[model samples]
Target: MAFENPSREKIKELLQQSDTVAVVGLSDNPLRTSHSVSQAMQQKGYRIIPVNPNATEILGEKSYPSLRDIPEPIDIVNVFRRSEFTPAIAEEAVAVKAKALWFQLGVYNEEAAAIAARAGLQVIMDRCIKVEDSILIPSGKTKK
Candidate 1:
């Protein structure tokens, strides 16, 4: 399946409109990109739901093992897992009705992205949420 990259404008609009993001494969270690990015988003007024089998808690939020486990709606499923594994993850993300799928830097699954896109979900690959937040917010004005 072929999928077009989401336009810059659509990406910006999604980022601005979303508040809760599910960080799939999130780790407990603060040094990890998953942890740091989630923390950054949290500070920026976005609720970060940590999804990992290894972690019981992270950033003061309860961690779920999968998108299906999240009781509340997830605006974005920010994937930190390997690119090869994203198809199943994308399927789960779709089944759970997440509004979008985000793959962190170095993570890109064109197949999975297409599946999500075909399901009417916004798809962003190889972009950092922290970077997006920082770039979108004006200097000296915190989003949170």
Candidate 2:
């Protein structure tokens, strides 16, 4: 069975209010999907904090090896890992009391979504932050 994400209204609210988003699995390579999406959010004015054990920095923000290491309050936890890894990440997101957990396209995790939901964290799975940001990009700034 499929899991449901927050409604459109909830997503709009979350995006409007989220300021600091921790991007788990963000890669140093700009060519990677995670890097590109994080850049999109950056352009939208959301601070992107990279969380990769191998990365010292990404998108100019200091990178942490784990969610628990991030000292600042995290509004959103965007994951770019495989489905098998999402449950653990979801647990960490819940533990940190994050406002939401987002799993990028191709990384859907029903169980993980349920876990996040149970923890009272908004969950979005199998979606791209970049595409969502594109819709938000104002007319002049966004290309057709």
Candidate 3:
């Protein structure tokens, strides 16, 4: 069976309910798409955890080398890496017990989606999290 992402309403609800997003491949450079998108999400009140091995910190949050290293619960695992790398990330997300796995625009992998889905993770592929939040949750605040 082909992989399908969650519905718009489901995604909206996920975005509303989620509090922490662990950004895999987040960059310290402001010019990068990962950095800009993560910054916007941070401004939207969600706690952004950077998961870049190279950077010690990004967007004022401490950076972890991998998902397994994050000490706190991760509501979402947002990935900015290539499609080929996502399957491993999905495995890590599942291992970390993240609620959702999101692949940024231009990043999509059927294997990764299947892995996360099988583990009961809400999988979103080839979509921009920042755009989704701006459109779905225009208020930029998670519902309490």
> Which is the leading candidate under TM-score?
3
Rank order (by lDDT, best first): 3, 1, 2
Error of 1 at 82 (Å): 0.6
Give residue 53's lDDT in candidate 2 (0 to 100). Answer: 97
TM-score of candidate 2 relative to the true fold: 0.91
**TM accuracy, model 3:** 0.98
Instruction: State the weakest 10-residue window (summed lDDT) of model 2.
Output: 135-144
- What is the Cα-based TM-score of model 1? 0.92
Listed in order, each prediction's TM-score against the native is 0.92, 0.91, 0.98
Alpha carbon lDDT of each predicted model: 0.87, 0.86, 0.96
Q: How well does candidate 2 score on lDDT at residue 55? A: 80
Q: How well is each residue in 34-104 modelled by candidate 1, as lDDT tens digits?
A: 88888878887888999998889999999998899999999999999999999999999999999999999
Best candidate according to lDDT:
3
Stretches off by above 4 angstroms in model 2 are 136-144
Off by over 4 Å in 3: none
